[model samples]
Every structure is written in C-alpha cells, then in structure tokens.
Target: MGQKSLVSTWHYLVALAAFLLSYFAGLPMPWIIVGVIAVGLLRYAILSKTSKIDAIPGPLVIVLAYVGFMAGFNHFHQSYSMAAIGLITTAYFTFLPNFALIFVGAPLIERTQKNTCIQFILSLVTASVVGVIVNLACYLGIGILFPSGVSSWYAIEPMALVWVLFSLFLLFKYKIGMLKLILLSLAYGFLLFLWRLNKMPMG
Candidate 1:
C-alpha cells in the first residue's frame, strides 16, 4: 500500500480507539467524533485529485502543542480533576483534525496555482463551522443523557469562541470572500453575545 493509504488506515484505527475509550469511560463523545472526523478528512485528502495531503507538516508540532498546553493546565489546576480532564481532552481532540489538514490536505493545497491561499482560508472557516455545530450537538446530547446539571451552553461557548477566532484569523490573513467572511463574523458576534449574557464572573 502507498504511504497515504497506510496513514489513512492508521488514522482509522486511532479514531476507533478514541471512540471506544470515550464510550466505555463515559469521557465525552465529542472528542471521539472529532477523532473520527479527522481520520475521515485525512482519508479524503489522501484520495483527492489535488493530492494536497503531502503539504502539511508532521504531527510533531501538534503533539508538542498539546503537551505544552496540558502541562500548563495541570500546573495551574492540579486539584481540579474534572477541569484537567476537560482541558486535556479538548486540547488533544482539537489538533486531531489539524493532523489531516496539515499532513494530508495542506501540502497539496499549498502548491495549487489556483488561489491556494484563499482555498486554505475558506477551508479553515468551513472546518470551524462544522466543529462548532458538531460540538454543540454533542454537548446537548450529553446534557440530556446525564442531566448532571451542567450548563450545556456554558460548556461549549468557550470552544466555539476559540474556533471563531481561528476562523477570523484565517479570513483576515487570506482575504476570503466578503460574504462568507461577513457571515462568519456575524455568527461569531452572535455567539459572543450569548456567551456574555450567560457568563458568570470568575470569582
């Protein structure tokens, strides 16, 4: 099998592991979904005509970032087990999709002569939107099943904001289509309004 096929197969296994672990441990389904999505995107990129999957840097950077963030969070919040788990899970799953983007889809995308930069920016925006929607659904489902009394909106609002900021950065850097940018911006603004209304002061 080709390197792309090998990588795609490995990603599938990793996603399966994530799903099983999350399901049995009741850790969180969103992370598993993210893992699956990452693997799926990686496979798609590898099989696509453009062959952009070769452009992304290795997973080293993302791994390092995850480790560093986890270290810092643990250092600051050692006593908070739930908070630590949430942070670690979020950080780990956040970069799984990037693995596909950078390793499988990015290189080919970068080399394209037809507005590659714009395409990259648009892809980020699209990914952010998808991530937000999926995560929101996951959070709501978890709340319904557990009834742990956690606020679903509060749980997801921060991550959604982070994705919005990321999308905004891409939009600004690459000068994506005006209409899409405006829509993303408006969506972000609406999310922010909701967050502010629900936010309790961190005393």
Candidate 2:
C-alpha cells in the first residue's frame, strides 16, 4: 500500500480502538458505533478528495460532541477517566498533517511525524479547549434556561448542540450554505432520536 493508504489505515485503527475504549469506559454502544462510523466516513471522504469542507475534522467533532453529550446527559460515572483518554486520543489525531490547513491552504494528510510533536500537542490542547468551551456553553446555557418543561426539549440531547455548533462554525468559517446547516441540524436531531429509539418508548 502507498504511504497515504497506510496512514489512513492507521487512523482507522486508532480511531476504532479509542472509540472501543470509550464504550468500555461508559459511552453507550450505539453512540460509540455512530462516532466510529462518522469518523471513518470523514476520513474516507478526506482521503477520497470528496470532502468539500476540511475545517471540521472527525477528531475535533468527537471532542466537541462528547463534551456536549456529557453535559446534556450529566452521565458522568466511574469510567470518566477512561472515556477521557479516548477523547484525548481522538483529539491528538487532529494534529496529523498539521492543523494549519484547517484555516487555510490544501487539505492536510492523515499523518503526523515525530519532528512535529510540539505542534501536534499544542493543536490537540487547543482543539480540546475550544471543543469543551463551545459545547459546554451551548449545552449548559440551554439547560439552565429551560431547567424543566417542554422547552427543555432543546437541551435534552447532545446531538443538536454538537451538530449545530459544528455546522454553524463551518457555515461562517468556510461559508458552506445556510441550507446545508439547517439540514445538518435536522439530521443531528433525527440521529439522536434513532439512537434513543431502543431505550425510549416510540423513541
């Protein structure tokens, strides 16, 4: 296989492992599977040169989504640390090919070298901070405002917050169309509903 193929394979492996760890660490099976599939598809899209937007990497998405998921559900438990490790791993992968490309220039390769460890670490930290702050603010703010009531429906799931924040960021930063953003937000809600279908009556 070519170097790029190798790197993509490695990304898939690591992403899968981290997601499995997250499942063991308390993330539900359905969410873990969805997370892995989403990241895998994003990787495939990037490698295939079919992705129109490169500003949102799967690792960053995972971090942001997970933060929102935690906040919305308040599901912290004994496996928090393990789940956190999985999140960190996902974030670390965000630095591969350098985060500089996220803002400008060509798409980055799915690979990072030892010489750029400092840059990788810094990017990981930065993305983690951004993810936490953005997701927490949206989820917690909605939670506080609604508290309890039919209005609280908006604050009940991480899916809406996750996709909304990411979609809005992409819409503004990269200028993806507003229609796409609306579709994504709707999709996120549907995705959440499907995931909960098994646990809730009529989902």
Candidate 3:
C-alpha cells in the first residue's frame, strides 16, 4: 500500500478502536460523540489533498499531544479553559507532526520531500508560538479555573502508564508499519475500558 493509504488505514483503525473502547468504558455519551467528531475532523484535515505533510497523519499528532496535555493536567494541576485546550490541540494537529515528530523523528516524511526537514523545524516553532499566544489570551480573558483536585490516570489505573509508554515506544521506534501502534493501542484501550467498566456499579 502507498504511504498515505497506510497512514489513513492506521488512523481509521485506531479511531474505530477509540470509539468502541470509549463506549465500552462507559464514558459519557457526549464525550464519545465529541471524540468521534474530533477524530473525523483530524482525518479530514490530514487526508485532504491540500495537506502538506504526507507521512505523518493528524490523528497521531492529536493523540500524542492529548496524552501529554492530559498528563500535565492530571499530574501538575495544569488547568486551562477548554478554549485553550482546543487552541493548543488545533495548533499542534494543524501544523502537522509538531511534538510527535520532535520526539519520534521523521524518517518517513523526510524521504517524501526535498525541504520537509526544514519545514518541520519551522512548523514546530510556529505551532509553539501560536500555542503560547492562544493560551495566554485564554488565561487573560477567562482565567485558568484550577480544579479542586484530579487523579492522574496512571495513578488511578497503573496500566495506563504502561500503555502510554508502550505506545510512545512503538511510535518512536517506527514500528507502525507493522500496525503495532494501532494494535497495541487498541489492546490497551480495551483493557482500559474493562478496568473502568469493572469500577462502575452493577446496574
């Protein structure tokens, strides 16, 4: 299969996994609906003919950024308005391969274009600046509503730590060609769903 096709397949599989596992997890229906819409939008953004980067799909970027963002919020009490979260997420995914490629490297994308390496650097800088600006604006306008407290996902579910680390490992190692990332993430998501389901009261 072609590179774009492969990337799309990966995203489709993962998105489906996330949707189903999230439903089984007993997440609020609204949250699952929004998540599906977000994935659909990311899929459209990355797959559109006008997309700049070929190898790195938008949903991968979203997942990496989201994991990092939630990790911070859950651990450090780093609270921000939903607007700021949306802006940050939008900026990272819109720019394509922002932080994910920074940590993972872009061997596949680099092979596709003559100047993408430079473009990658510039895009990273731009995304960072935009993220900071929007975050500041949100803080100044609405203020960061600090929560009373929040449990870290890893603490609440120790397996989450393993799941995240393993996901990042495969992503960094470029094992995605084997669909290891999708499969492993789906496995982890399913396990997470079961964990959450078990915690819910018997109806």
TM-score of each: 0.22, 0.24, 0.27
CA displacement after TM-score superposition, residue 99 of candidate 1 (Å): 3.5
Model 1 misplaced stretches (Cα beyond 4 Å): 1-79, 111-203
Q: After superposition, how far is residue 85 of candidate 3 from its true place, in Å?
A: 22
| Model 3 stretches with alpha carbons more than 4 Å out | 1-156, 177-179
Cα lDDT tens digits, model 3, 1-203, are 45455335434443443433221222222222233333343343322211211212235345434433442343334455533553364344424433444345556546545686767885675666466445433332221121221344323334544555666677778656546665666677778779889999996
Score each candidate by Cα lDDT: 0.46, 0.44, 0.42
Top lDDT hit: 1
Q: List, residue by residue over 1-203, the lDDT tens digit for candidate 2.
A: 45466346545654543443321322222233333333353333222111111113234456434533332222234355644654454456434323443434322323443448856785775665466446544433454334353354554545445665687689789998867766775676578668888677762
TM-score attained by model 3? 0.27
> Candidates ranked by lDDT, best first?
1, 2, 3
Name the lDDT of candidate 3. Answer: 0.42
Better of 1 and 2 by TM-score: 2
